[model samples]
Target: MVERLRYPGGLRLLLTPNRSLSWRGNVRIWLLLALVSGIIAGGWALAGVWFILPFAGLELMGVAAGIYVTSRNCQRKEVVTIEGDTIHIESGLNRKEHDWILPVRNTRLESFPPNTPFDCHRVRLANRQQQIPLGDFLNNADTDALVHALKARGINILQTEQQPTVGIWF
Candidate 1:
């Protein structure tokens, strides 16, 4: 999801991934699975199959961890603020954040075409020193929206046929 807010200085783009399930829904799913598995496993354990109990506990723990990670990822966000002659970007998952500042004139955006297998469109923000990926967590439609929003804000976007890969020098 791309939210465009026009601040006093310039534009602010708030980017988030599209979530099909709500927090409550995710929790409900985990709870349902855990309850069902626990009942079946406990019944089997009572019938002399003691090994099923430990396996069921492990399965429950794994499911809980997976749901937790997914929830944390859903909380992730990237904020891009274009003010005056510079653009500021703050992005991270959870509490750890990274900041980047680039002069408006030096900054540019590139749109890479989707691959034959994945069908994921990539948008990247770059300057002389670094290139930061934008909307990498979003879907194709959301990425399209992000590109359009940046373009509407006077940022030039370049289309690319292939994704650029960097190779380390020996």
Candidate 2:
């Protein structure tokens, strides 16, 4: 999910990963799968293949573990707010939150292409002293839209002639 709000003097951007399965939906699917597996395993157990029941239980446990891990990060979000001469960024994943504050006049926005074709591109805000990445879960289109929105707000984006070139080494 990508949402952008433009105000008279600033902009707010929200980015979240798209989740195909909700927690409730996951539980329903898991229960259905367990029931089917149990019925099959019970039939085999009745036929004297008792080991099949334990193996099915093990498989169900593995599936449950995967679902639990995935649900932990499903609520992750990246929030960006640009007001006056300041930019604020807040991000959270798995209940851990991080924040960054940058002066609009001194900060520069930099975008890096994904390392591989399958990876999502990254955007960062940096100054002479520090740099912080944003939008780790955003897809290419959302990242691009974010950059465009920032530029529209008169924010200095790296590589633009309006801002001095800063070495990428930082």
Best by lDDT: 1
Clashes of 1: 0
Residue-level lDDT of model 2, residues 103-160, one tens digit each, is 8899888877765455676788899998887777778898888889888878787742
The per-residue C-alpha lDDT of model 1 at residue 9 equals 83
Candidate 1, position 102, lDDT: 85
Every candidate's lDDT:
0.86, 0.83
Clash pairs of candidate 1? none
Local accuracy of candidate 1 as per-residue lDDT tens digits, 1-170: 88987688888988988888988999999899988998999899999998998889998999889888888788889999988888899998875389999887878898988754455889899887999999788888889988887887778788987655444531
**Segments in model 2 whose C-alpha atoms lie over 4 Å from true places:** 5-9, 94-96, 159-170
Deviation from native of the Cα of residue 27 in model 2, angstroms:
1.1
Give the C-alpha miss distance for residue 116 in model 1, angstroms.
2.3
Evaluate model 1: give its lDDT: 0.86
C-alpha lDDT (0 to 100) for residue 43 of candidate 1: 91
User: Which residue window of length 10 is worst by lDDT in model 1?
Assistant: 161-170
